[model samples]
Target: MRKERILYIYPTLSSFIKGDAEILSREYEVTHFRVHPTSWHSLLRSLISQLFHLIFNLRKYDIVYIWFADYHSFLPTLFCKRFKKRCYIVAGGYDVCREKKYGYGSFTNPIRGFMTARSIKNCTTVIAVSKNIKQIIRHVFPSTNCVTIYNGVVLKPGKEDVEKESLVLTVSMASTAKNVFIKGIDRIIEVADLMQETKFILIGTERQLLEKIGYKIPDNLQVLGFVDHSHLQEIYSKSKVYCQLSRRESFCLALAEAMLYNCNPVITNIGGMPEVTGKNGFIINEYSAQNCSFVIKKALEAKTNSLGRERILSEFTIETRAEKILNLLESN
Candidate 1:
């Protein structure tokens, strides 16, 4: 039997995007197209290249699978609609959000917002990473076809013999100043300052960036640049608690990964954090440092168990996502 051909398009090759591609590849012929637009010039160049690519290659694929509904997705969805091809767009938080304060989200910009909304409307289906995101999409575009598909993670078994320490951890890409605020790095620093006894480890951002933003690094907090998966797993094994105090998050893969390692989660009640945390860990309704510090203390003191690991295994495994997404694409 001949497998259907799928054209996979994404702005960046994130782990979740790569996971979806791998899933689709098991049952379909998949081709990857990266459209990273870091600047205005790059955006124009990417669009031109994509236009040409689709113009010449659109007919070969049975479906167009896009990661996010942003400028990169506008052309693919538009082309798919014109050619009567099935197009599925996975909507992460940024696409449907309108965070004006930090200038986050595609909707923060007028032109980007229009293109993103149109892309969602034109696509055959929009896959929201969380129920919160699905609600946002329906609220903004009432008639758009949308469904919730939680982002999946590969379960990493935590070593039972590994001694977990009094360490607090968070993973985020905080290269830019806006990202520092959006990912709640500021909050982490504040909490770290308040809780001087507990050690805080922040991965995926550099100490230089924090210093550049005029943030004084506390003695107990260790800021690290991005580390490989093996190193991250090692960090997860030793950490007692994982914290995600983001202003916005779609599915929070890091939180899930930490839970898989049996790290107690202390997250804000924002976007998908609460959904991901469920009853497995602590949730902080207030974003203040005092409040988050209090929550982290409680999480650190809580007994370690396999409940977090069990939740990920049952609900957010890669196998579950593969089954659901494959069925959706094949049926529609």
Candidate 2:
């Protein structure tokens, strides 16, 4: 069969610049239509030019892979409808499930609902990252065909004992921002600072507000911002835990990577995280920093290294997710 010319649309180039797109492209002729951070000068510019590109380019590819973003997905819907193409949407988080419940700021709730409704209605298929998201989509768009494909990372198990240290980690784009509203950064900071022995590393970008808070970030809590994806596995290998404090996530990719490296998870019991962690990690509901501390203690004590790594390797892999997507496309 001739290779399918797949056009993958994501809000930013970051998603495609990362592992998922590269891996997917190995099987399909993938082209990415993405917006970079430097390009968005103002709202008027983005609204007019970007939207035009998104709409006009819809007919160019045999298969259009739309990333799950409520705002961006709206513009593409115009093209999808106009061209009458087969499209598949990937729902990763918040915008798909949160916007309807809490509503996004500025953008009218009805508009988001309509855009999602169109994408859900017109797409060939919808891939929900977790069961929780699948349930929400089924509830919101009853007619849409949706499937659960958990996010994952390709793991190369390391030798040396990971017990080299007893440290917990929270990885995100927000660095040292006192108000880490996204991904529960503040909560992780609160939880990390309260605990003893367990060190926290804040990888990604740096935020100024975090330094002013006077939380007295000890020598243990290191903020190494913006790490390369290749280095993440090594970071996981040296540690004993991965903690994601975010209230909303479609699937915590970092948590999965940590699990693959034999680092147990101490994640918030939300979204697809519970499904991803399953029996391998400790889950905290909302707050309860005391509980976060306790669970990390227990996971450390249990020393479920081989078993935890096994779960991630068997169940979660980018290859597996890509294969699932391929199967769905071929089946249709």
Candidate 3:
């Protein structure tokens, strides 16, 4: 039997997006399309390109799968509706949010909000990365079809002989001042300052970005920018705790990745984080540095075991996500 052909569209090729493409490829002929736009000129060019591409080639694919509902998603969803094709959009965090404080989320801008809302409503189904995101979508567009599918991770074998250290880690793609607060880098820095004895490693952001925010970095907190997957796994294996003190997060993949290495999580009670942490880790209700520091101490003293890894294995494995995604796509 011939497999269905799927057109996968995304703004950026993140790991999670790539994972979904790989999953669909097992049962479908997948074609990847990137619609990343950096400037106004590029945005215009991208829109023209997407319109022409779909106009000519959309009928070649049986289904259209998009990673996020944004400007890039607008044309695809609109075209799918016109052509009477099945279109599924994965709503990760920002697409469903309107966090005005930090100027984050798709709805923060009026034009972008309009496009995002239309894309979400017109799409055949919205695949929410968390129940929190699904609730947000249902609240805004009550009649839109939505489903909760937690993002999954591939489980890595634990190094039983390897010993964890007194290191706390966090990963965020924060570069500006607003993102510092949004991703809670400021809070992490404060906690690192307070607990001078413990070492904190922050991956995915530059030290200069933090410095520009008028904050002094403590010797204990190491800002290693971005590390490759192998190095990240090595760090995860050695770290004792993983922290995410974000003001807003839809679903944090880093926290899950850390937990897979048996790194006990210390995260804020925001978005899908508490849902991800469950009873396997610690949750901080307050965002203050003193409060976060206190929670970190508790996480540091907690017993070390495979509970974190076990939770991920049972609930958020790639195989489980693949099965669920295929079922959703194949069913009515």
Candidates' RMSD to native: 1.0, 3.2, 1.3
- lDDT (Cα, tens digit) per residue for candidate 1, span 1-332: 88899999998887898899999999999999898689898889989999999999999999999999999999999999999999999998988888888899998999999999889999999999999999998998999999999999965677866889999999998789998999999999999999999999999999999999999999999988889999999999999999999988888999999998889999888998878878989988877888788889999999889888888888888888999999999889
Better of 1 and 2 by lDDT: 1
Task: Pick out the ten consecutive residues of candidate 1 with the lowest summed lDDT.
Answer: 154-163
Best by TM-score: 1
**Candidates' C-alpha lDDT:** 0.91, 0.70, 0.90
Ten-residue stretch with the least lDDT total in model 3: 153-162
**Residue 296 C-alpha lDDT in model 1:** 93
Error of 1 at 310 (Å): 0.4
Q: Whose TM-score is higher: candidate 2's or candidate 3's?
A: 3
Tens-digit per-residue lDDT, 237-315, candidate 2: 8777777877677677778777777777888777788887787678787477787777778866656457766777788
How does residue 114 of candidate 2 score in lDDT? 73
Using all chains and alpha carbons, the TM-scores for the candidates as numbered come to 0.98, 0.85, 0.97
TM-score of candidate 1 on Cα atoms, chains taken together: 0.98
Model 3 misplacement above 4 A: none
Q: What is the per-residue lDDT of model 3 for residues 137-240, given as tens digits with 9 covering 90 to 100?
A: 99999999999998988646568557989899999988678878889898889899999999999999999988887999999999999889889999999999
Q: Name model 2 segments beyond 4 Å from true.
A: 15-17, 36-47, 50-58, 99-110, 160-162, 175-179, 205-209, 212-219
Best by lDDT: 1
